[model samples]
Target: MTDIADLPFAMYDAFTDVPYSGSQAAIVLNAGQLSTENRMRIARQIGVPATSFVDRIEGTTVSLQFFSTVMELPMCGHGTLCLITRLVDLDLLPCDSDDWHNATLDLPKGKATVKYRRNTNGRIEVMLDVATATFAPAALDMDRLATLLGITPDDYSSSLPAEVASADFIHLCLPLRDLDAMNRLQPDFAGLAAFCIENGLETVAAFSTDVIAVDRHLHVRDFCPAVGVSESAAAGTTNAALAAYLFRNNLVKPEGADLFEIRAEQGLKLGRPSQITSRIMVSDGDITRLQVGGIATRVIEGKLSLPSPDSGPLSQQ
Candidate 1:
């Protein structure tokens, strides 16, 4: 057994350029040698929604593992962005002569493409190439759904129906009428968690076209209790799914081009106020490419003390 030591870690607020304005994720450096149990223990101790362990960096390929306080995850969108930003900030993925540097991420599900480059102000900009989103109509009762969100059925948007969208994770895509309904959301965390688990979902992505910023496309709030978070400030996968949902319903379409960009505002109610960007490329009425990206600010950098391995095995909640 390895002796207890201070494990180096960095926390970054993802999906935003300013610190403390986005979702937080912890990136544990040099965590390749840790056992799965140890990683889980560390994740629980960190108590973040998502924690990334930097396993290895070989040339242009980076191996990473993501864990929540409850269990291991196949992939994490915000976590990936934060991890990439951390790598760049540490000078591990230094900028070259080219405008952008491309890398591959070794995730538990599969390999994913990543592009990063330093902006004019030298802040690292990272974009993750996510899986093409596919959606299925959800059979949830509108009344029940309304009760779940503490809103009335009349508050739902008449434009789009509820759906289960997938792009690495599953989210119940719900549409609200306006920002007022969004501001009145009062989710039953326990009930939401139970519903998510029963439906094999990760989050309920509530979005509206009524955005505060004129340039933004949607205002979103992600409720994810099944995966251990009550509500996410900014979720990568959920926003990617939201982008596809809009495109599928013809809510947003490209008139003169095949690529349509989607900008979403999230976490405002939580006071984090994250901006998430996604692009969808269409080819002959079919989605061909999907990408989500944003900038992150490093907030806390320090070492974490590992619990004694002999104390007891921590079980997933």
Candidate 2:
């Protein structure tokens, strides 16, 4: 019989400084030797929308694999943020507390950069620089989208139009008139899932400029039913896409000549309030790069026992 191994894992609520709020993700340490099947099983057992498997930590570079409850994903934004926070909190990275430290993430989709440092409040701040997304007008019917979200056509924002944005994933961006419209959203999950799959979309991001916090630029709610997540408390990639959409449509003005920073709030409806900071770098007249980052709070730490190879079918718990 093969000996079972125990893996250490930590759960974190990403995109919030509070302990229990924000989106939750699990980071499995020393998961390099685990097989793909084992990784999938582990993710399911963690019971989170997304889990990060640490493949290797080499110098200032970390290789990671992300798996959702259902299947593997190219990359996970909140998961990456949580992993970076955990690494810095554990003192695993080589860095000085006062200065910003740069790290590279080797993901299944591609390589990205991360900058982190211990802030004045003694909390770690992680900034993830990801690929700049491209936008295309969605061909889907507006009336159908309104019905799918259980909202009326009048609730849609005329100023900010709908578009399909793609970064690491594809998102259907829906602009609503106000926070009341955002609050009234009651999506048909099964129908939304089918709609996403047929439309080659991943998530539906409904957003409004009216925010709860005076400092926040936008408020968003992301629904990812196709990936088995009915709604995400906080989604970095989806927010990044929203940021790009705002810039592309000239909705937000740059703070400086070449940089624009957006404070986005999410998850109030779910009560797991999250804050995401998205930074956009513009060159000449076009947006060049996008970065999403946030503070994460560690919630749980435990060990997971690896299942034996010869074990029968595992529980779907």
Candidate 3:
């Protein structure tokens, strides 16, 4: 009989400085021996917004898989951020060394890049290279949005207009007017979930570029209960999609500038306020890179013995 091994895991609050705030992600390092079912079982056990399983392949490069307690995802931005930051926090990488500031992620879909750096203020920030933020026209059901999110058409207007934006999966970009409307949101979960199915969408991001808080270029919220994520406190991909939405419309940068940064905030209503910064690299009129990063702190660590092979087939909780 094969021995069931013990799997160790750690949880980190990503995109925020405060503990128990931000969107928490669980990480399982060196999980090469585990099966997909085992990873899914482990993710369900942790009960975080998302859980990542990492299999080390070489120095600064690892194969990663993300789960939402329901199913596996090709990639997850916050989960990736937590893994990169945890590597630094655990001193698994020479985070302070110039040569050790970068890492490559091998996801189910493809390879992604990440860089770690400390600002002049001595705060550590992890930057992801998602080069995949892109946009295409989206056919939106405005009435369904209003019925589910309680946002009247006049409550907000999108400068960039609605579209399917992607850093990972396609997210419907719904630009609102300001933070007040976001804070007042009480999304109808059942209705929203149905909308996602009927429309073949997993998530919709509603945001306001008009800053309600000083220095925050955007205030946003992402809903994805269709894929089992009711809400995400701070999402790396969602913010990247927002930046792409803004950039395509010529919103943030000067006429000829290439590099740009956007300050953003989310999760205020849940009280787990998260701050994220998105980096944009435009080679011409086209954006060549989409990266989002922020501070993440470790909160919990534990180990669990895997289910016995003799046990019945596993199912998500």
Tell me the TM-score of each prediction against the true structure.
0.93, 0.95, 0.90
Model 2, span 1-317: residue lDDT tens = 64566778899999998988999999998888777887898788788989999988999899989999988988788998899988877778865766888999998778889998888988888888877788898899789878999999999998878999988999988899999999999999999999999999999999999988999999999999999789999999999999988888888888887999988999999999999989999888787878998889999998877755455433112
* lDDT tens digits by residue: candidate 3, 112-133: 8888876555556788877555
Higher-TM-score candidate among 2 and 3? 2
Ordered by TM-score, highest first, the candidates read 2, 1, 3
**Better model by TM-score: candidate 1 vs candidate 3:** 1
State the local distance difference test value for candidate 2: 0.89
Q: lDDT for model 1, on a 0 to 1 scale?
A: 0.86
> Which parts of model 2 have CA positions greater than 4 angstroms off?
1-3, 308-317
RMSD values, in order shown: 2.8, 2.4, 3.0
What TM-score would you give candidate 3 relative to the actual structure? Answer: 0.90
- In each prediction, how many residue pairs overlap at the backbone (N, C-alpha, C within less than 3 A)? 0, 0, 0
Off by over 4 Å in 3: 1-4, 98-100, 118-123, 158-160, 254-257, 307-317
* Candidate No. with top TM-score: 2
Worst 10 residues of 1 by lDDT: 308-317
Cα lDDT tens digits, model 1, 1-317, are 54555668999999988888899899998877678887888888889889999888998789989999998988788898899988887778867643888989998888999888888887778888888767888877668767988999888888778898876888899999999999889998998788788878888999899999998999999999998899999998899999988888888967458998899999999999999989888889998888898888899999976545554453212
Residue 47 in candidate 1 has what lDDT? Answer: 90
